[model samples]
Target: MCRLIGAVSRHRAPVADLLGDDLDPFIRLACEHKDGWGLAFRQEDGTIGILRGIDRADDSDRLQHALKHQLTDMAVLHIRMASPNLAVTVNNTHPFGDARAAFAHNGEIRPVAALEKLIDPDLLATAAGTTDSERYYLAVRERMNRGVTPGDAITLTAQAITQSSDLVVSLNAMMLTPTGLYAYAQHDPHSEVIGRRGPAYFGLSYRQEEDLVVVASEGWPQPAGRWAALPDGEVAEFPALHP
Candidate 1:
């Protein structure tokens, strides 16, 4: 399993500050998730910038510098622990998406070969690394290109995974679009609680007054306001250009 954090603030604020003492704990958790790590954020121009690596996120000097220097209204962070057969490389890091969007996933898909068959060959051709997460992203992109909304595409992807293997998926993922942010989690009965965080492992909290929204794999301990856990199977969308 992996961990992720995302935020969209009304005013530019340092995420490191908001995370507080949680930062060290979260980073420690990420260090155990040694496969890879990534961070993506939107520029003032709305262009997405991403930095990723196969090293432990807590130990990466480059990632640390980028995080300390870069501040944005919107951002996504991911820590990965590669499942068997998945390669560890920068390209395989989470928070993958194009200009119009960004995504981070925390889950594993079983029978990877079978799932690969459902993806469009052209999109797969563009793959920079071999990881189920990347395949899942491409699958969603292909479905969207064929006129499917992100929600519908995700549903289809989930359905495809179910058909390919009996292995259940506990997909905790988020999508950040020009319009808003969306998140979904699919947990199975067999899921185990490995960390100190409660059963509700993922949450998205926002302060409308401040026009700030935050989505994290685990909730922060401070700076409390209106933070809500996104229900399973539902997608939370925020307007890109708010009125």
Candidate 2:
């Protein structure tokens, strides 16, 4: 139901620099995924900064400004298509998080109350939007509160969701933390999106160099030789050097 891209680099730089030409094409996907957009990155003072817009990324000057202005060592971008009933609002737009972490999810999880049952009541109360994606974030955060690593928490969260409802279209997401950018891909292969958008619609891919590593959702032009498809039901972590 969305598209996401993120990267970890050895040095702070604009997203345009980290993602290169792929950024434009990725932005273009906003034409179809035109519900809203968000970007999250580390600030110079060592806090996470998240900027979101209620307009499409391709047409928003805010997105263009952030693309060139928000420099950081780790960053994630999300363009939402929005699920059937979810409203398109700033609170519902992603790259959702607090001071330490930001998360963006690209899939739809049904009967959200099912996942909500898995999150602690106090933690679940922190959610601002009525979105399955926001609930997914809180569920992952609940696991992290118990000291689980981000990547493992993602895996566990997916398992819990499946065991409860098994209605996941895709759990694909990017979580940006101070240490790294975490990308997870988990989805039901039989989901209807495959027949409509091809087999790779829910697939994720990454390209890594010595100092830079990038992960992105498929559907655009990412060279096969440079970007390798991240396996379904797996998490990829790209660490960034601290200043």
The candidate scoring highest on TM-score is 2
lDDT of each residue in 1-243, candidate 1, tens digit only: 688776666655555653434457667876468887887776767777777888888888987777777866667778887876777877778878878777788777766677679887777888777777777777777888899988788778877776785565566777776655667767664554324445655444434435655566663353555455566765666544332
Writing each residue's lDDT as its tens digit, candidate 2 over 19-63 gives 877898999998899999999998888888899998989999988
Off by over 4 Å in 1: 13-22, 191-209, 219-227, 241-243
Q: Which lDDT value does model 1 have at 187? A: 62
**Which segments of model 2 are wrong by more than 4 Å?**
none
Q: What RMSD, rounded to one decimal, does every model reach?
A: 3.3, 1.1
Instruction: State the lDDT at 11 in candidate 1.
Output: 59
Worst 10 residues of 2 by lDDT: 234-243
In model 2, which residue pairs have backbone atoms overlapping below 3 Å?
A: none
The number of residue pairs in model 2 that clash at the backbone is 0
